[model samples]
Target: MRAAVFVFKRFCGSSFRLQNRGVCDVAVVGGGIVGLSSARELIIRHPNLSFTLLEKENELALHQSGHNSGVIHSGIYYTPGSLKAQLCVKGASLAYKYCDDKGIPYKRCGKLIVAVEREEISRLKALYERGLQNNVKDLSLIDARGIREREPYCRGIMALDSPYTGIVDWCLVALTYAKDFQNAGGSIVTGFEASDISMATESPAGEPEGLKYPVIIRNTKGEEVRCRYVLTCGGLYSDRLSAISGCSTEPRIVPFRGDYLVLKPEKSYLIKGNIYPVPDPRFPFLGVHFTPRIDGSVWLGPNAVLAFKREGYNLFDFNAKDFTDALLFRGLQKLVLKNLLYGISEMYRGVFLGAQVKILQKYIPELGRSDIMRGPSGVRAQALDSGGNLVDDFVFDGGVGELGGRVLHVRNAPSPAATSSLAIAEMIADELEVRFNL
Candidate 1:
């Protein structure tokens, strides 16, 4: 395509309709942080290869990536040698570096997980030990006096200081990545939903076994395209996409709505950086925390409650089909039965504004029920196994000479996911190299 044509079409937001648009070597099915980061890495690693990223929305980062807490995790909560730990540490540095080079705003404001009473002390100590194992730098155990020094208003008896933890504008980061990808000869097809994917026929004669078939992709607008490989990084719809690709994983995505409260402008400075509660060992999400956003606003939140729709962001956003599907899913039934007590409590808090205010008061005693307001909410895409258990770690399943050998499916890319984007992309690239001779 000519430079003039590219410029004119991009300006018109009709770049995908260009008649001479190039074919793709790789087709990424999602435009969130993971897919875009993967697209950027693939292009950077092999500039000669053509690539395209498809998003259902008119703009990128419209979902999880856009609504995240803006915290750059410190790698202190994950187990050692795990993908979450490795990627978080490495990707945090890369995220900061990219933000610096692009002149995007970010801060190394630090985080704390506080223990309010005697019963929580054991969990607090365990978190400190885990931080050490994860190689988190400058982590310390702080008593009440020390905690007061870090956060004067916090009401904790003991705390775990994670200095490496900080905040960044993730949506800004995603926007920056989109710009970088396009500048480096990559195509992003927004408002183009990936409706279907199918394997191509094997070539005749001496064609290499690895590059036998391309993954055929059809967009929502009824346009069909093909690529030598497919990388599924659909955030909320990841498992569903895998099911469509002929994988029998059967992980039904259960949306958990995490709501927040942006403190009134005057009360914003009540907590300096990020102040967290030591997490429940059984739960995957970090308990409610105070996070300072890049725009200098302090917010509290992220209570996990079942959502009626996969992308439902509001209390009134509901789909009968989605609700019935989740209700009938045997796995969800098992999961609920196993954690009935906690599930009930979370639902109670979800309805009562006072219950949520109590969770906040543990960390910030000055916060009153009247000081809270409905902050923007985000939906978490949680996956459940056939037996009704939440998949807690990164899970990938593929092998040589398989049904979808080279096409690696991303089943669950959860929290710390944005923080781990670049590292995960590198790992995916490495896997392709080994499995398909990329």
Candidate 2:
């Protein structure tokens, strides 16, 4: 039955045609949280606008949105005045409100960023200051005693407590967004894999005279959809999708696989809430940390390692095209060289059980090898530029080639993206409003 459904969906996705069916005001690609949220935002702002959302997969949130740690970031780690900071801080409140209104389950359990070494205290202080500057409310600098009070088994010289940090089932949140979008007269099509985008030489009738191009979106199954405008929230394949739409190729998406270890049920009591390490300033990834899920499970040690495939969740998973892309990218070569030692350590932890446990022991000394088994893993789409620098903030690009102003692409959205989906959608919607003169 599953095989039949998969085959039928694939056939429909490839053969489906919307060219004669009707024209839509807008089309949204990617059915993750961001895409759904963007569609919902568009509907809310312009209730009568005709819009459709396309998901390549059979269901929504099957990728990054569903595989995350479910931690609701408090915007403490991002730099002040950056898009991440602004969106995350606002997005958390919006997320909570939406969840409450929708009757979705979530937890307001706070988080702790622990500094085990004396040298980390200064860095911790800096993070605290940044959090304050970002207007992260209820943030406090805590000493070792305070850490114990909040998380008894955790040990550190000092820590930063973010009471606003919480957790939720992001997949559920995304589904709710989809429901609201549908309620507002938006259409969602699953299994529609967008393969390329091109501009129509002439604008469709009734479109403004100045609107030079109506966008044509083609999917893998030879189906096509014509719309006045398109928005892409293509998480892992964002860069490729943008390139297909005639956007620049300077910043490419690099996949990093984050593998976690779940604590044995009997030992889950050793930690409460989220416990994190003071992140290394040089890199964007937050190191391995402990996260308590809404399902009452505690997860640890999601060390980032280069993934051979963009969606490769398993260590052995490989794709010839994805692997060659990463290997041929000059930026990735330089990035690996610069972080050689750190990359080696992460790889080692992934292979060796003891190495992974040792890193976790820095915070919870009682955690041993037997206390944790393998847990779920996720792949992050880290965008890298030609200079080998990681793109630290949200990247949105459009208005290029002959399709200028007819398309918008979300090129880079990583961690906190799930947390900031709604806010990001609003930002994208605002940009579209001005660009398209809607």
Q: Candidate 2 — worst ten consecutive residues by lDDT sum? A: 1-10
Tens-digit lDDT track for model 1 on 133-250? Answer: 8878899999999998989898888999888888888877777677778888888776667777776565424546654445667766676656777787888888767876777646
Which candidate achieves the best lDDT against the true structure? 2
- Which pairs of residues clash in candidate 1, taking residues 3 or more apart in a chain or in different chains? none
Error of 2 at 78 (Å): 0.9
Instruction: Please give the distance, in angstroms, between residue 169's alpha carbon in candidate 1 and its true position after superposition.
Output: 0.7
The reply for model 2, stretches above 4 Å from the true place, is: 1-22, 201-213
lDDT of 2 by residue, 1-438 (tens): 011122211211222222123357899999899999999999999987889888888777888998899988889988899999999999999999998998888999999999999998899999999999999989999888999999999999999999899999998888778778877888777777999898876665676864433678888877777788999999999999998877888689999999999999999899888999999887657798999999899999799999988889999999999999999999999999889989998999998979999989999999999999999899999999977899988888995776777888989886799999989999999988988787
Where is model 1 more than 4 Å wrong at Cα?
1-22, 201-213, 282-284, 397-403
Error of 2 at 432 (Å): 0.6
